[model samples]
Target chain A: MLAKRIVPCLDIKDGKTVKGINFVNFRDAGDPVELGAQYSREGADELVYLDITASHEGRKTFTELVKKVAANISIPFTVGGGINELKDVDRLLSAGADKVSINSAALRNPKLIEDIAKNFGSQVCVVAIDANYENNDWICYLNGGRIPTEKHLFQWAAEAESLGAGEILFTSMTHDGVKDGYANEALATLAENLHIPIIASGGAGKMEHFRDTFTLGKADAALAASVFHFGEIGIRDLKHYLREEGINVRL
Target chain B: MDVAIVKYNAGNIYSVNYALKRLGIEATITADPELLNKADKVIFPGVGEAETTMNYLKEQKLDVIIKNLKQPVLGICLGMQLMCRYSEEGDVNCLGIFDTDVKRFIPQKHEDKVPHMGWNTITQVKDGLFNAELENQFVYFVHSYYVPVNEFTAATTEYIHPFSASLHKDNFYATQFHPEKSGSVGEIILNNFLKL
Candidate 1:
């Protein structure tokens, strides 16, 4: 009876939401706490706040913002980026993040995922794989998609699941910022191969993209950034569209 | 006025506190037995492994304290699973308050996934756990193990199959889903639990 989740990814820079064209060139979005509350009110199933530049001093500020957003919003939200140690996970979860997503750190040390899953339940830790279709196949990338790994996307996703990631956020670099559609083919492969939930990230242009991802990609959730932030799609209306398209969304 | 959340290395108890805060109620997270005993309502909220957490609770003697709590006690997710007679997780026995057994979810088909995560509707709600206006509303859930339908089952949800989504007996209530994360549907449930 689980409905497909619609998530809005807010890139946080100094506690404010920012929109990065593709993976760079940041533009001011708005206050994260305000946007998060609005998304929850507008029927966003979940939210992810990714700290873009996670410095030592600014980490505290983002943590405080997460606390504020968590208090203001009733729906669950997760915090990620620059989480390198167990203490960071503890701090974010303590500050009221429902879950913590690890990207570059997990790529560096898969055991980080293992340790987190061992300590906190696997349900709390999410492994986000930033990947791109390159050289005839999908290749995984790390460090904000700057460094490409030889690791195959499907193989690494399976490894992450074994390493205790409760969910996998698969963001396709090629599809990101293009406003075309989601990487439905790769997403479908991940969904079919993995037993855990697959959160399809990047490449969400219009309302139909979300519908296609759930139907064609078979993703458990579809995530977008600019589409939601730039007023291109209101979450309430998107859910209304999805519902009309025979998608079971909470309206 | 004194609502205490029993904390024992569990995950996401802060959201529950935050939910109560939105309702204009401030809850204290504590492991102190005396504080829990004195509170008007005690919420046993958790998101952690059962056996390891059970060991921690035993080490702190919170097992006996929780079983003996006279106030309206509500357990969430792992807290609810641990309240059962036994759990398949880590092959461990649990606090025997509900007299039901918790089983690990095994996907029946290739499409059916474990860790039945995301929003699902809870039907057949009873025992004041759910507001009447919130009948069959979708609530957020993220757990792998579930308590089967039993005499104490108050609400049920279907995923891989129909299972106990909520349980109630006497003054004790519990849920397999996270009300703190279920948006307005969850807020209503928490409000009703407080009213109870």
Candidate 2:
């Protein structure tokens, strides 16, 4: 059986790990390479490094961080944020990152998805969508949910799958920092509509949230930041809990 | 041992090199025939489409060198697929090192996702690359196409159905999963192969 993954996302700014609540008011976590290595030792299924930095030098620093992460951590990891073109993807992958996740750039140019899949194979492309629940409809957002787009969640996810995205990492801004639970209703719908795997992001407080996401949302994986960063949740303990709850997880 | 990673026109070879580095072995990555032939063991790693990679291998004469190698060779992911007799991916012929054919996974239900991404357990392990410690251990896999369980299957994994997780025939061994990226268990598997 394919185990449900527990991912610890490390949001990078100026080459340091930081976690923000609802995409604002960031707090320093620790060094990315060290944090990532700790997570790996604790039996984290995978790791995600989201580079939130905007400067060109920051981008260069992020690549160096990626190299260090790949060399130190044995588990597979994905690198995202500020990936606008094919060259960016190449740079990260060449640095030994297992996969590359694209968010805003993929939305602005849907063709980017196809080009990545064609050149590097679909397994290498992970399309991350950030959205908010408004007006009884899930509206897509860009720039870390600061700007809204006309695209709806379900339709855009279907389009991304058709456009050759190997996986969809959907983060609901409405429940991001609530620490209540995941947007299971919308997530289950997306899982049903797309053939590729769905990674549920945001709103993960307890082990039950992961269980609910896997059972109700049908998510193949669950990603969280602050909870895992602040020692609020231990990955090994979480996996043991999930396994006891009948959710398949790598122990 | 002089370990050399066969480098053709393929992706994701760097991770394999890094994995070996973690084991304290600085394996050489080269497309040169001389280096490959001279190595004690050769690792043919890839992550790309079948037909295109096969074409590139032929153009660079890597296909012939790989087929004629006498040392132990391990193929991973697409490299494993290319070792088969044929692949449905690009509707092309492969190196025929293993008497099997690769087929794209068809989703049987809503949950049977393609690319079988993430960690999955492998069973029925019996080969030089696998030991008692590896039985039923989870490994990382991310691919759309798979080789069906057959005579050469050294291990099996169940997703939509039981498929070949690893194949062993004589000195050639191949795994559908990326052992290098599979964490600690992956480290053990690579160590086993290196010791062989």
Candidate 3:
């Protein structure tokens, strides 16, 4: 049986982790390698390192950090943020990152998705969509949901799948950071519409929310940041909870 | 001990090299037949299309070198698929190291994903690369095509149906899942392969 995945996304800035994590055993909590190892020890199925750095030097540092993380962590990890072209994907993948996620770059040029799938195989391309619900419609957003786009969420997601996107990372801007839950209704629609795997993001506050996203949202995986970093919920305990609820989780 | 990873045009060999590094082994990633033939262990790891990769392997003569390897050889994902007798991916024949055929996964239900991309548990563990402790252990897998359960199957995983998660025949061993990306359980499997 394929276990529903639990991924903890870490924000990276200038090669270091941006958010303050609450793990006390670490020498430096900001080290992405250490944090990634800790998460792996705590039963995270995968990790996502989103480089939030703006400078070119910082991107180089992020690449080095990716090498360190890959050398230390055994599980799969994806690198995202500021990945605009094939060279960026090649740089990160050559540095040992398993996959790369593209967002605004993909929206800016949908052809980038086809290029990635063609050059690196479809398994390496993860299309991340940031969408906000407005006027009773899910509207796609750019630049981390600050700027709205004309593309509808479902239409763009379907188009991305057709463009050879191996997976879709859907983040609901309206539900993010609210601790309410995932947008299960919208997620179910995407899952039903697309053949590729769907990774549900943006609203995960508790273990039950994880269960809801897997069962109701039909998400193949669920990604969260603060809850796992701040020790609000432990991954082992969450997997156990999900297991008891009859969800197939890697325990 | 010298370890070599056969590198052709496929990707994801870096992850396998890093995984071996975590195990305290600095493996040489090369396509040179001399280095590959001299190494104590050869890892054939890949993540790409089977037809193009097979063509590249034949062009580089890595296919013949891999088939003649007497030392323990491990194949992963596309490497594993290419080791089979045939693949439905590109309507191409493989290296015929394993007496099996790779078939494309068809979605039986609305939820049966094509890639089968996630952590999955393996059952019916056997000797070569699997132990009793490794039974029912979860490992990461990401592939669209799979080799159905066969005589050489060392372990099986259930996705759409029972399929060969790993196969073993003499010195050649293959895994459909990425043992390097499968966390601690994967570490155990890789260690087992190295130990062989």
Candidate 4:
């Protein structure tokens, strides 16, 4: 039986770990390298590094950082946020990223998904869809939820799948930062419709949230930020909790 | 001993090389028949469509070269599928190193996802790539096509159903999962393979 995955996402800005992630016992949580290695040791199935650095010069150093992190950790890792074209993906992949998650770039040009998949294989391409519920419908947003798009989340996910996305990382803007629970309804719907793996993102604050996302949401993986980052929930403890809950998690 | 990773239109080769580097072993990534044949250990790895990769292998004469290698050869993911007798991935024939067929997993339950990507436990572990210590430890996997359980299966994992998590046939070895990315457990598997 394949164990459900637990992923910790680190948001990076200007080559530094942002979001004030403070692991009191771990001294170097602020450094991405130390943080990534720590999470891998704590039994995190995978890690996602989202580079939010806004400068062009900062982009060059970020690729180097990806390579450094990839060299340190052995588990599967995904890089997202600034990937805009095939060249960007190539740099990240060459720099040791197992997969590249494309969001706004894919929304801007759907062909980018097909192009990256064609060149690097779908296994290396991930489609991250940021969706928000508006007017009784789940609408997709672009540019980090700053810009809204008419595209529906369901339709975009399916389209991305058809365009050769190996996996879908669906992050609900509405559920994000709420820390109540995941968007189980939308997540389940996507899981029901998509053939590829659906990684549920957003609203994971507690151990039960992860359990619900796996059972009710039917998600293949549950990804979160603050819970693991702030030391509010330890991955080793969470895996133990999920195991006791009868959910098959990597322990 | 020199190890050569057969690099031919594949993926995860870099990761494999890095894993070996972690163990203080440097491996050469090459498709040249002479190098592959002469190496102490050879690894076949890829992440792509089987048909296109098979065609590329044939064009480069690697299809013949890989099949004839006498050294201990290990294949991962698509690399493992290509070494099988045939694959349903692109409805093409493979290297026939293992006596098994690769078939696409049809979801028995709605939760049975394709490309069974994540960490999973391996049971019935053999002593080849997987040692006794790693008998029931988890390994990372990402593939749509699975090699069904058969005589060559070294270990088995249940996704849609029990499938070949790792395979062994004399000097030839294969794993459906990525041992390079599987953390300490994966490192042990690779380390065991190197020891062989």
* True contacts reproduced, candidate 1: 0.88
Q: Per-residue CA lDDT of candidate 2, range A1-251, in tens?
A: 99999999999999999998999999999999999999999999899999999889999999999999988889999999999999999999999888899999998999999999988888889999999998899999999899999899999999999999999999999999999999999999998899999999999998899999999999999999999999999999999999999998998
Best by DockQ: 2
Candidate 3 scores a chain A TM-score of 0.95
**Per-residue CA lDDT of candidate 1, range B144-182, in tens?**
898889999999999988999999988899999999988
Deviating ranges (above 4 Å) for candidate 4: A20-29
Question: Which candidate, 2 or 4, has the higher TM-score?
Answer: 2
Evaluated at residue A145, the lDDT of candidate 3 is: 70
lDDT of candidate 2 at residue A46, scale 0 to 100: 90
Where model 2 places Cα greater than 4 Å from the true spot, the runs are none
Docking class of 4: medium
lDDT of candidate 1? Answer: 0.90
lDDT of each: 0.90, 0.93, 0.90, 0.88
Compare the candidates by TM-score and give the number of the best one.
2
Residue-wise lDDT of candidate 2 within B72-103, one digit each (tens)?
Answer: 89999999999999999989999999988999
Question: Candidates 2 and 4: which is better by lDDT?
Answer: 2
Q: DockQ of candidate 2?
A: 0.87
Candidate 1 per-residue lDDT over residues A1-251, each given as its tens digit: 78889999999998788987789898899989889888898999999999987688899898888889888999888889999999999899889898899999998889999999988878888999999898789988989999998888999999999998999999999999999999999999998899889999989999999999999999999999899999999999999999999998877
- Could you tally the backbone clashes for each prediction? 0, 0, 0, 1
The lowest-lDDT stretch of 10 consecutive residues in candidate 4 chain A is A20-29
The model with the greater lDDT, 1 or 4, is: 1
Candidate 3 lDDT, A107-156, residue by residue in tens: 99999999999999888999999998999999998876778999999999
